[model samples]
Target: MNFEAAKTLCRSFPGVTEDTKWGNDIVFSVGDKMFAVTNLGEATGMSFKVEDERFLELTDRPGIIPAPYLARAKWVYVEDAKALGDAEAAELLRRSYELVFGKLTKKLQREIGGA
Candidate 1:
């Protein structure tokens, strides 16, 4: 998927907020915790949290790698937007949102109507 499509998919999730961080990266967060990030200048790469079990499996694929700086937290970077189909991209993004959301405090989840 392209950057716009990825941005739109992230925005569709409940309680997601988008902001520019680190000068050029676009971050998507739920309850103040980031779930996804993409570069502003190019669609060269995008990063999102993945299930711990899937991290190694995903990184083994071409065009995908363990995210720099955040790899220990089980984030994966897609080096090529076209590496994944639209449906798969959407699913991974949604899962990223869910993973982050699940970690938020219950009170915050209630405030976001995400509990």
Candidate 2:
């Protein structure tokens, strides 16, 4: 999946936003909290959260590694964004969105709901 595709999928979720930060990095957020990021200049790049169990499983694969500064938080960096396939990548993005969205306060969720 390319960054453009990723950004399109990410923005499909409620209360989602995107921005270019740290120069060339594309950051995706929900409720103002980041859930995924990728370096635009990199040939193949995407960093996203996964379940802790999958974290151990994924990092064992080639072209995948603990994301810099966010590994401990269960984020994995995909050297080739398409490594996971388009459908799988979309699923992961939704899961990441749900995980981050679920953490928001009830009030915030309600407000978002109203929006």
Candidate 3:
């Protein structure tokens, strides 16, 4: 998907926020934590977190790769947007939001819940 489409999808998540971080990378967040990031200026790819098992399955798929440095645990990179359709991209974003939200502290969860 194009940048605008990507941004639109990301912003649909509850409390999701976007900004440039780590040298031109576009980062999407819920609360203060990141769930997805795009290297639009340099790599033309997006990095996102998935369950460890799911991350393995996705990285094994064609055109998907383990995100550099961040892949040791839960991140994967979509090397080309064309390899993933809009539905898949939205699913990934949803999974990421769930994963990150699940990890938030009880107080934070309550705060986010109130939002």
TM-score of each: 0.93, 0.89, 0.86
**Residue 58 shift from truth in candidate 2, angstroms:** 1.1
Candidate 3 lDDT, 1-115, residue by residue in tens: 4545766788787778888887778888887899988865554778889988788788888878998888985898887777678887888878998899888898888888877
Give a tens-digit lDDT track for model 2, residues 1-115. 6656876788788887888899888888988888999766543688998888899888988878899999999999988664677788889889988888889999988887778
Better model by lDDT: candidate 2 vs candidate 3: 2
How does model 3 fare in lDDT?
Answer: 0.81
- Predicted candidate 1 versus true structure: per-residue lDDT over 31-57, tens digit per residue: 999999998866568999999998988
Q: Give me the runs in candidate 3 sitting further than 4 Å from their true place.
A: 1-3, 40-43
lDDT of each: 0.89, 0.83, 0.81
Cα TM-score of candidate 1: 0.93
Which is better, 1 or 2, measured by TM-score? 1
Q: Tell me, by lDDT, which candidate is best.
A: 1
Ranking the candidates on lDDT from highest down gives 1, 2, 3
Question: How high is the lDDT of residue 6 in model 2?
Answer: 76
Task: Count backbone overlaps in model 1.
Answer: 0
Clashing pairs in 2: 1-82
Output the lDDT of residue 80, model 2.
Answer: 66
